[model samples]
Every structure is written in structure tokens, then in C-alpha cells.
Target: MKTLINFAVILFFAIAFNGIAYSNDECSFNGIDDVLYFQENSISNLREITVEACVKVNSFSARKSGANEIWQFIIFKKNQLDHFNEGFAIYLDEKNERFATSVASAKGIQAVIVDKKHSVELGRWYRLRMSANSKEIKFFVDGVLVKSAPTGFPLDFDSEELFIGGRTKILKDKDFEGRFCGSIKNIKIWSKVLDEDD
Candidate 1:
């Protein structure tokens, strides 16, 4: 009788532990080629959006031109790479040694690049958040606001997909120029602009 009771207790604990592990696994992204693509209907329009993720920068490299940096995370229109008419990207600028964010639209590209001195260190985990609406756009690192700017044009969400850990083309092309070497987890997306307190 005692053995039966002990066996039941162990089984209960095992099931509980497995549930916790599975929950964590749902949000984690590992490897240089890790990406999560969303179906068009899976996500709502991107007019006002918030993207948050916990990232550990394993490495950083400049793109082919060496002028534009590699984006670590991007919400982009399919098949539109360099001249994306509607999209947003967060990247590490090796040349300037700073973290940067860019929001592009048919109107123009509005970039909020941190100064060279505010570069993020490698092999450290940091919470990166970006919120945008028609009025403005904001970037945050480690729960602190790093950059903010006015945003007049709304993001185009038609046929959009989310790219994590690295850009889409770089993953397929095996191009190290704009590839991200890192681990990303706990990615959350919202259809509405999130407040500072959120």
C-alpha cells in the first residue's frame, strides 16, 4: 500500500514538471536560423503594434554593404527585403556600436538609432521592446526607454510575417553578413500600442 502511494505522488510531480517545461518551450527560439512565421490571419493589422522579446546576443555582424547592420528581429512584408515598403526592424549596428530601430513605410523610413556609446554587450540577456502607432514610436531596452520619435505613417500589415533571431533572406542564403548569432525567447506581440507601464 505504501509503495502505491509513493508511486502516485511521483507521477503527479512528473506531470506537473512536464507542464511547466512545455510552457517555457512555447516561447523560446534557439539557433541562428530560428524563426516564427505567422499566417496572415493569425495576427491582426499592424497599424498599432507592440513587440517584446528577451534576447541574448551571441554575436553581431555587419551586412554585405557594411553600411546597414543585421536585424535581429523583424516584422516584414513577404518577398520585400531591402526596399520594404512597410515593416519594422531592430538591429545591432556594429560600425557605430549601438542598437537601432527602423520603421519603414511608403512615406519614408523613420529610424531611431541610439548613439554609438550605448552599444549592447554580447552574451548578455536584455529585454527589448518596441511600440508604435500613428502618433509615435518608442524603443526600450531592459525596461528603460532608449529612443523615441514621431511616427506619422502607419505600418503596412498586408501579408506580413515575423522573423526572429535573424533576417529571412540571410537564413536562406547562408549569408553571415546580416545574420544574427543569438538566442531569443519570451516573444510577445500585441495589436495595440502598449503603454510604458505595460
Candidate 2:
């Protein structure tokens, strides 16, 4: 009887801890060609959403595109399109030294680019979170509110697959656009907008 009780206690604690971890939505990434893809029916008709990630940049440099150098960290992307104006993504623009969060709605591509006074340091871990509702979207870094912008319209997309660490190839010319050069972990996505308490 004592052994049975001890086993039950262990099982209870294990279940409780597992539930906590699942609610946190933790995921780790290798930051190379590594990508996480979600099934088509996993999420649909999202009115409000939140995405969070803890990331460490391994390097900061730009890939040459003719005369221009583009340095960016493609954090998250949903849907496929020929250009940046066709989908939703949250990325770090190293060339501009800012965080760019964009959503392609029926109106157009609405983006909020927040410039940081200090450049992000490589090899250091930072927590980045973006929350969006019908009215506005909020960007947070390390638990501090960094920027907020009008959402413009409801976020609607037809793509069934969601990509992490890089974007899905929309155009052949843009295929190489979203390769991140760092490590990402503890990625979480929520269907509803999260507030301070969440």
C-alpha cells in the first residue's frame, strides 16, 4: 500500500509539471536551415495572436544583393508570397538596427519597426515577444514593452503551414531572405492576445 501511494504521488507531480511546460510553449531551434512547420489545420481564423522567443544571435552580417547588404533575422513567418508585403512576420533588421513586425492584411502590409538606442549584442540571449489583436500589436523585449502599433485589420491568411527560424519560400528571388544566424529556444504561440498577467 505504501509503494502504491508513493507511485501515485510521483505520477501526480509528473503530470502537473508536464502541464506547466506545455502551457509555456517551449521550442528550441538550431538557427541554420532548421525550421519548424505547423500543420495546415493547426491554426485557422486567428483574430488575436502572440508569439514569443528566446534567441541568441551567433553573428551579424549581411548577404550581398547586388549593391545592397541585407542583414536580418527572420524570426517568424506565416503564409507564402513573392515579397515581404504578402505575409506576416516578426524579424530583426540588422541593417536598420531595429525590430520589424509586419502583417499582411487585406489592406496591405502593415509594419511596426522599432529602433533600439543600443545595438543588439551577438551571443547574448534575449526574450522577444509580440502580441497582436484587432486594434493593436505590442512588441516586448526582455519583459519590457518596446513598441506598439495599430493592427489595421484582422489578420487573415490562407497558408496552412507556419514557419520558424526562416520563412517559407514565396519567390525564388526571395528564397534566401529569412535565414537566421543564431539559436532560438522556447518559442510559444497563443491564439489570443496576451497581456501583462499572461
Best by lDDT: 2
Q: Write the residue-wise lDDT of candidate 1 on 108-161 in tens digits.
A: 556454534646787778777778777788888888888788877766544555
**Which residue segments of model 1 deviate by more than 4 Å?**
1-36, 40-44, 62-86, 115-118, 169-177
Across residues 108-171, which tens digit of lDDT does each residue of candidate 2 receive? Answer: 6675647484457777888887787668888888888877888777775555556655554231
Model 1 steric clash total? 0
lDDT scores for all predictions? 0.54, 0.56
Looking at model 1, residue 144 earns an lDDT score of 81
Listed in order, each prediction's TM-score against the native is 0.68, 0.71
**Superposed model 2: Cα runs more than 4 Å off:** 1-32, 62-71, 79-86, 169-171, 174-176
